[model samples]
Target: MRNPKKRGAAGNSNRAHGSSAPGVASENTDGGYNAGMAVFSYIIGGIIVWSLIGWGLDFLWGTRWIVLAGALLGAVGGFYLSHMHGLTSSRKNTGDRPAAGGPSQDGGTNAK
Candidate 1:
């Protein structure tokens, strides 16, 4: 009969804690403050840059609506980009899979 594979110290600790390895920190470990800051920066930065461009265009074309449109577009784009990147990073750190989006066994998307 073949001997059963043995679980090492780290392996046993991980299994015991429902697959979360000891000393592992989640993506949102610090009350999501970092992510919040990142998203905020994205939105604010986008607004500032696009609004400046719009202001310059308005100065040249004498149109008042361009700034509004640019700001709105920038906000939407920033929110979208931030949300996408956040999801991707969270999935990566939490071992989410590509198929069903659940946790993966290898701490990331399944290789096969």
Candidate 2:
């Protein structure tokens, strides 16, 4: 007759033989920041920059249009900048997976 503990150990070894070591899994090395957030940050930064420029011009020139113009330009620029930033960073981080357009894995784009 064989010992039960010996049999259990043998069984355990067999289970682990053909498998990957525990906790060894494919991991993304990009710190997990997705494309949307990247774009959002870029847009926000652009807006701030443009807004400041506009505000400075308004202050110096005594014109509110300048500031308004700056805000408008900033909004447009922000959208584009953010979108591009998001796409580029996403691509770099996610490898070959598509980062924009045609239905994302996480649903649709949040662009406004």
Candidate 3:
């Protein structure tokens, strides 16, 4: 004789696939976190490396302002590197090309 007091399914409902804890996201990142982390690491790493180089130069050349210059240069170079890697939003949303030739950023189409 089967029990009639059960209200729902017998298995655990809170458990998720590929994970044991609850409230975990199942969507695939597709390397989204990798790109973001790369951007962050590039900026911070550039600054640290340039500052060290500048410190060495200052020690050799006997100047106190080279470190500041190196930090500034690092910031600029980091931004440039990020742009070169195409990690910025300028190249995003490339898969949604409208079939009707939608308007561009300038509020107009490129078609003649």
| lDDT for predicted candidate 2 compared with the true structure | 0.64
Ten-residue stretch with the least lDDT total in model 3: 22-31
| Model 2 collision count | 0
> In every candidate, how many clashes are there?
0, 0, 0
Candidate 2 residues 1-110, lDDT tens each? 77776757555653444445543222433434444565666667777888899899889988888767776787788778766544544334347665567665755566
TM-score of each: 0.52, 0.45, 0.55
Better of 2 and 3 by TM-score: 3
lDDT (0-100) at residue 89 of candidate 2? 42
Best of the two (1, 3) by lDDT? 3
- Candidate 2 lands at a TM-score of 0.45
- Candidate topping TM-score: 3
Model 1 per-residue lDDT tens digits across residues 1-112: 4335866564355443432554433543543665677678888888888898899999999999888888988888789889887622553433564555757677766666
The TM-score ranking, best first, is 3, 1, 2
Q: Looking at model 3, how many pairs of residues clash?
A: 0
lDDT of 1: 0.70
